[model samples]
Target: MDAANLDRLVDTDRVHRSVYTDPAIFELEMERIWGRAWIFVGHESQVAEAGQYFATTIGRQPVMMTRDEAGGLHVLFNRCAHKGARLVGEGAGRADKAIRCCYHGWRFGLDGRLLSIPMADGYDGTRFGKGCPEADVQPLSRAESYRGFVFASLAAEGPGLVAWLGGAASSIDNMVDRAPGGDLEVTGGVLRFEHDSNWKFFVENLNDLMHPMVVHQSSSLTARDVAKAELGPEATMPPALQIIAPFTESYRFFDEMGLHAFEWGHGYSGGKTSIHAKYSDVPEYNAAMEAAYGPERVAEIFAVNRHNTVFYPSATIKGPIQTMRIVKPLAVDRTVIESWTFRLKGAPDELLRRSILYCNLINSSANLVGPDDQEAYRRQQQGLRAEGAEWVAMHRDLGREEDLGEGHLYAKGSSDLAFRNQFRAWKRYMAGVA
Candidate 1:
């Protein structure tokens, strides 16, 4: 599609339905957006030891993150050099001494260099050999990690990951700082789920603050009712109620939480507070934080309580909860999401346990909360098939976003400002503007 056509599909306050429903546009996004954007791969802790590898995809392109013997980290094309068979299966595994392709005995080192091609004497005259760099498993264009969270981009020439992250970088910083020792690790595995709709639906919904009270009424109301019935008014709230019941928060509560929008379609909601703010603090974890950073610094860190930071077109993270969900697009109408929970080093295990509980309660495929959102996405995918509505409106508080003189814009949490800011960056990417 040309620049003009992509421009027509997006506007300051609304977007054409085709942006979410078109196969051609999805392809363009895979190229122009996901292709160049700094997509999160996996955390470095997942491959802390040598020869361990984490397998993931960048916009349907199979890629692997491997740690070498000397602790060098490389993100490479998962395909083997010889006939292009994928070297590792999905998920994490140790490559052992070297990656040996099953189709042919093509062996490659963890650093992506060709080690040996079996029966090499048979092809002495041909170009296929260990000496050629083309025989090695090729690396991605660029890969960088921030505080152990590895992100790779297919495009080599762009802003460095830090510059590209803009204000959204704070979410990551705060997440790592939450750890008393300033470290985090992916633990308890990941919860994999699928959405039978466009990937954009999930990212946009991350900070589309108006939908939680409405879309999650059934689950949240059920939880709220059960909590009131099961526990005394003076009783301490249980972990389960602390999580699921937050969806019933008043519109005023969410609106006061505020929303932040940054460049490159990256932003987060709830700088001062969030649904997570009311979670009963784990005293052990708080003590550890206070011990590590002292009371004043800990208070300063906790004061910036944010929610649902979107890296955009690929992943969304909840820093307060220490959970990240990765978006993997399978087709125009199919998307897979993986939720990974983290452990804050030097904090008590109860903190990690709570993080896992939040992950499962909200992001698990079989859970009450995620399915509600998934069903809504499914209906949206099914409904947009109609020609009745040509455009999706995003006009709430259209001109009300505040230029905070910081690095990004802010607005009332309930406004559609987040969506408008998102599509503006979307146009820049899909239209090939800088």
Candidate 2:
């Protein structure tokens, strides 16, 4: 579509229904939006040792991240140099010495160099050479990391990862600092969630505060009842209560917690208080943090409790919960979301357990909360097919948002500013602007 046509699909407040349901727009998104953004690959902890590799996709393109023998990380196209076959399948494995292809037995180094090709004499005078650039497993144009979290962008010349993060960098910093020893590692496996709707639905939902009390009222109220019944009114709150009971919180509570929007479709809600703010404290974990960073620093770190930080098209991280959900769009109407939990190294085991508990109870596909949101997304996907309404409203708390400078805009948590900000970035990207 031309610039003029794409410009009409999105407006200041509402966006066209075709932006969600059109195949052509989806194709353009896969090319312009997903292709250019710094997509989340995987955590460094997954491939800690030399020769270890984790395979994932950036948009529709298959890619892998490996820790090289020199202790450096590299993001490479999973395609084989010789026959264009996928070098490694989807998962984690060790290829310390060489990454061998099952198709033709072509071997590549951990850093993606062409190590050797079997039957060497087959191309004696040909353009194929062992160390030639084109004959090696190619790395992406740009790859960078922030506090062990890795991200790669196909476009090489845009903003670096940290600069791209802007005000949201504090969220990552707080998550890392929460560890008593100031480090994190991926643990407890991953849960893959299937969504039969546009990928934008999932990302947009990260900071959508208006839906929780309405859509998730069943699960949250049930958890509230279960908590009161099992443990009397005077008893301590259980993990399940800490995890699930917050969905029924009133709009006033969320509005006071506030929402934040940044440039490039990045934003979050609940900077001061979130569903995770009042988790039953673990004494050992708090003591460890005090020992490592002292009470003052620990207090500072604990103060910033961002509910969910969306890194735009590819990922949304729950800093206080130490979990990340990856968004992978498989087709125009299909998406697969993967939730991975993290362990705070040297902290009490209770923290890790809490992270896993959070994932299983709230974030996973079969969780009490997720399916409610997914069903809403699915209904929108199906209902948007009608030619009756052309625009989807996003006018909640529109003109009331406050600008916090440095590309940050703030509003009540119930505001639809996040959706409007996302669509603004979507329009810019569709028009080939960075």
Task: Give the best candidate by TM-score.
Answer: 2
lDDT of each prediction vs. the true structure? 0.89, 0.91
- List the candidate 1 regions with Cα displacement exceeding 4 Å: none
Q: How do the predictions measure up, each by TM-score? A: 0.98, 0.98
Tens digits of per-residue lDDT for model 1 on 1-434? 88888889988988999888999998999999889889999999999999999998999899999999899999999998889999999899998779999898788999999988777887688887878888889999999998898999999788899988888898999999999989999996789898999998999898988999999999999888877788856677889889898887989989988999888888999988898998888898899899899999999889887879998878789988899999999888999999999999999989888898998899998888999899999999998999978999999998898998756899999988778888888898887764
Pairs of residues at least 3 apart in sequence or in different chains that clash in candidate 1: none
Candidate 1: give its CA RMSD in angstroms. 1.2
Model 1 earns a TM-score of 0.98
Candidate 2 weakest ten by summed lDDT: 123-132
